[model samples]
Target: MSSKLNIFEFSNPSIRTLHISWVAFFITFLVWFSHAPMLAFIKEAFDLSSQQIKALLILNVALTIPSRIVVGMLVDRFGPRIVFSALLFTGSFLCWGFAFATSYEMLALFRFLCGFVGAGFVIGIRLVGEWFPAKQVGVAEGIYGGWGNFGSAAGAMTLPTLALLFGGDDGWRYAIALTGAIAFVFSFIFYINARNTPKGSTYFKPKRSGGLEVTSKGDLYFYLAMNIPMYIALAVLAWKLSPENLGLLSELATNTLYVVLLVLFVFQTSQIWKVNKEHLQKGVAEIEKYKFKQVAILNWSYFVTFGSELAVVSMLPLFFMDTFELSAVTAGLLASGFAFMNLVARPSGGWLSDNLGRKKTLSVLIAGLSVGYLVLSQIDGLWFIPLAVVATMCCSFFVQAGEGAVFAMVPLVKRRMTGQVAGMAGAYGNVGGVTFLTVLSFVDASTFFMVIAGCAALCFILVQFLDEPSGQMAEVMADGSVELIDVA
Candidate 1:
């Protein structure tokens, strides 16, 4: 595949696939977050309490952590083309249901279910990775992620105006339903237009199903250890919604959810062991071994990068409004500059990774991320508005670009399991979001910034252990032939 990509090259199948995949992802995100900008209207309409509002926020992202993992595995098994379309199709009804929900309970259930749409990001990772070659995959994935992610911002910017255009108590409902309608239409468009691979290229599948396969017993343990954080993040979210905290969940309900999480974790661990046991017992070939640490380290990298982005984006408008004494609209616009950077920064991260080498590029960006957060830790009433906005955007560039860099390495890790790898890494991003945001509920904004800066420091240390991709990786064809894919 050529390294050059032209956005206007609609005649090219690969270019066309990129456009379709990104649009599918964009619509999912728009539908997923469409509830956010119209929350004020929903609150008045439903007579929601402050606690109920906070519960809605928590519920929105509640399912995403596991859904990404499940979606990732599905993509690996069924191919991105089907999984991507199916996810969008399923999420559309959930979106519409949430839109028309008449009660808080109905709203909470659908909002939690809508979290499934967040997994849409995991699907595009594998799809773009398949369509583009190693030399260009980074930028290709970056463009897919960066531009596609704009849906949230677009929802934030446009959804309210759309509601006003509809003009009534039910206006927000129609606005949200319209997003679902678009998602419904595009799911079919994606199913028809997206190709799993370029004609004749093999679509690889993992040798075993049920769980991610690891090479060594040591890696088996490491993979299991990494799974704990995702559970812990969920547990923490439950605790946040428990009677003592936000009081959205009754104590009995919270305890039941905790037990459910524990049971699920145990079940998942067994599935993982079952998947890797035979190979570990018989001793796998050297050629098949890839370090699980690569995935673990990348998980933590995203934990800080995209995780901070989620946590910060949620709080930024408030942070700006309070610290800078700006109006809600002004603060929201300035805060949006952080997300706006995703358009250029993510692709730039991928392009730099492609050109400068993945490890080196990610390292520099992460180091900058640490610095950026530390600077953000100092923002207060003393800072000027424009300067603060510039600082926020600069930090976001490193944050979102770091996310692009993380996924750029994901597909390179394992060819057949790119979906699972991206899925776990994607799940970790949500884990990070939950973890960091939970931290925010306790501490002040400055402390939250410092805590993230501290996490970024840890990521910088972890990135050092990453083995840069080079030479070639080997994958087996169905008939037992070995295919070597160039990574350098």
Candidate 2:
């Protein structure tokens, strides 16, 4: 690692890799969310209810939680270039399938599977981490994440306009299909141009492929424990579509999914044990030992940070329209501001983490987010719209910035497991969405925001326990050599 590779000065190769990686992620997100802005059109086309629409939204993310874990392992083992490109190309096909779906069931199936592409975020994180040194990883990942995340915002801004330009009952379908085609073609370009690392740099491989390697017995148990929540989230989603809730799922189908989920959980736990059994018994060196609990804490933190962001962004427009008695168009534009903060605040969060300490930066951002949400909980039509906008914007900064800070620490946790680590953290974001949205069904919109604030406050306390990355992590190379990657 070299100080000369600070944020301002980096090799063109690193910069180019970052740019390409982020764009790849951006395009994936664009494809992932191309349906969102056109939901009204889809609703009309399908004659859907508000509940079914929400269920469709829920379905969009249902597969993502598990797909992220699978994709993470694939990236860690096979490298990001192949994994990401394959995801985009295959996901593009799914997007096209969704566009042509004549039945709601078929559309839901394709949209749910498209969630797999959301794991594109994990691939770019590992790619950017490989290209940049530890000193600059924060900003590089920040830029990668911030700019890449804007794809959803970009979709919100552009897809509707594109649909209008096409001008027909099926215009939304064409607009969405165009995004898929772009993703499909770019997948080939990404595969051809993107390298796992700069020439002459080693692309480090994990010791095992199927599961994460843990250094100690405690970490092994902790890893198993962390996996439980992901399954729980899936179960929650199933329940939401079950007869007891939205009634979109038959009792038999819902129960079958639950049983399958349980079996999958058991299989995953078995793989985890098999991968790390020897290492847990032999014991790793002190320098190589890192707590899996750190990853666990961040998992819960992101469940709130990015999770709330996802859940809130989905419902905010309707929340505004109902509460403020405003037009859908105006409410949607106002809600767009929440996601718009990603372009700047997310990078600012990472920059702050780099200048300050990771824990300190996370604590401050979480606190601000908690307070911001609390203030948001108090909003009413009596308040001025500008004041309301200010409140939302203030909360957006903390929420998106907190996301940047959380990832600031992600790459630092374990180098070999960075993809898996990031993947799980990312899964929790979906988990939070499922969890918070369930709460929203039971409570008022104001209480929903307050619930997230409470969750953030709990995560803030947990942030105090994280050990800042400062020294180095040792990764054993294939040639019986040890490579020291900087974590400071």
Candidate 3:
């Protein structure tokens, strides 16, 4: 494998995979967020109340937290090619359902289902990890993640105009269905072009299927402990939609969902134990062992970085509009800068992780994220608009860059479990979004910024405990022969 990446080298199979894989991810995001930009048209068409609109927003992310983990496991078992292609194809139908829904209930159901599309990010993580070497995986994964993430921004930039051009009450519907068509077509394109791994390279699979295989009994408990926050985040979302809050869901429905979540968590716990019981009892070979805390710390790091990005993107436009007394269009255009930075900022983080040590790079980026948010906590209407925009962009750079750094280490943790590792970290990012957004519900803008900064500071400290990836990981092949994969 070459130490240097020539992104323009299209003839290279790995480069081709990187380009097509990111486009697959981008289309999923485009479908996932297609509703957000055209919400005004839909609201007008359906006569939605403020509370109902809030419910739609909450429902949009309701399934994504768990879906990411599920997709991760699927990617590991089935490989990225099939799993990603299927997700894109299926997501298109959901987009169409949401676009053409005649009733609010129908709209809510499809939007919640659309949350599955967001898990498309997890599939590419495993795909990109397979194609790139340890030396270049950082930036390669960065370009995959950073550019793929821009799909949401791209949708926001273009979809509204598209709806307007379609020119009627049903224009939003047609515009959204068009996004679905692209996803459906691209699904076939990705499937036909993408390969799971390089020629002659083995695609390692997990020894057990159900849950992540932990090394020690202690790590087994730690893995279980780490999952509690994800369930808690889901519960918070349920509460927001419950009759006591937005009244979108009746008390009976909310309680039933709560019971369902509890049952699912118990079933998941058993699956984790099932996957690890035999291994822990036999005692894992030292050479085959990897620390579960590496996974845990990355989870928290992503929670701080990507989680804050989701929360901020949702609120920044409103924050700017109110704070500066600007029109909606003006505030929205200004706020777009934060998301726009992903194209460059994320790849730069990966480049730094590749050149600088991963741990050091991650730590510095997290610290920068903390400081950036702290600086944001001080912004006010008294500040000039251009300066505020610059401050917001600067803060987003660290947030998104930290996210890139987190995933850069994910594939290195356990080559076989890269899908699951990426999935868990990706899920935690949503957990962070839910947790922080919940905080924003009760606080001022400055307080919300301070809360994120405080959490980033704690994550910065946790990152110090990470042992740098400097050696090789040993994987047992199907024939019981050992294969060594490089991490450093």
- Once model 1 is optimally superposed onto the true structure by TM-score, how far is the C-alpha of residue 145 displaced, in angstroms? 0.6
Extract clashing residue pairs from model 2. none
Whole-structure CA lDDT of model 3: 0.94
| Tens digit of per-residue lDDT, candidate 3, span 1-488 | 66679999999999999999999999999999999998898889999998999899989998999999999999999999999999999999999999989899999999999999999999999999999999999999999999999999999999989988999888899999999999999999999999999999999999888899999999999999999999999999999999889998889999998999999999999999999999899999998999999999999999999999999999999999999999999999999999999999899899899889899999999999999999999999899889999999999999988888998899999989999999999999999999999999999999999999999999999999999998799999999999998999
The reply for model 3, stretches above 4 Å from the true place, is none
Q: Which candidate tops lDDT?
A: 3
- For candidate 2, write residues 1-488 as lDDT tens digits: 54333444435778878888889999989989989989999999999988888788888899999999999899998999999999999988999999889998998899889898899999998998888777777777888898999998999899999999999899999999998999999999999989988788777777877788887887788888888988998999999999998888999999999999999999999888888887767878787788887898889888888999998898889888988999999998998899999988888888888778888999999999999999999998888887898899889999989898888889888888889999999999889988998898899988998999999999999989888888888877778788888788
- Taking the tens digit of each residue's C-alpha lDDT, what string does model 1 give over 135-205? 99888899999999999999998999999999988999999999999988988989999999999899899
lDDT of candidate 2 at residue 486, scale 0 to 100: 78
Worst 10 residues of 3 by lDDT: 1-10
Better of 2 and 3 by TM-score: 3
lDDT of 2: 0.88
State the C-alpha lDDT per candidate.
Answer: 0.92, 0.88, 0.94
State candidate 2's TM-score.
Answer: 0.97
Ranking by lDDT: 3, 1, 2
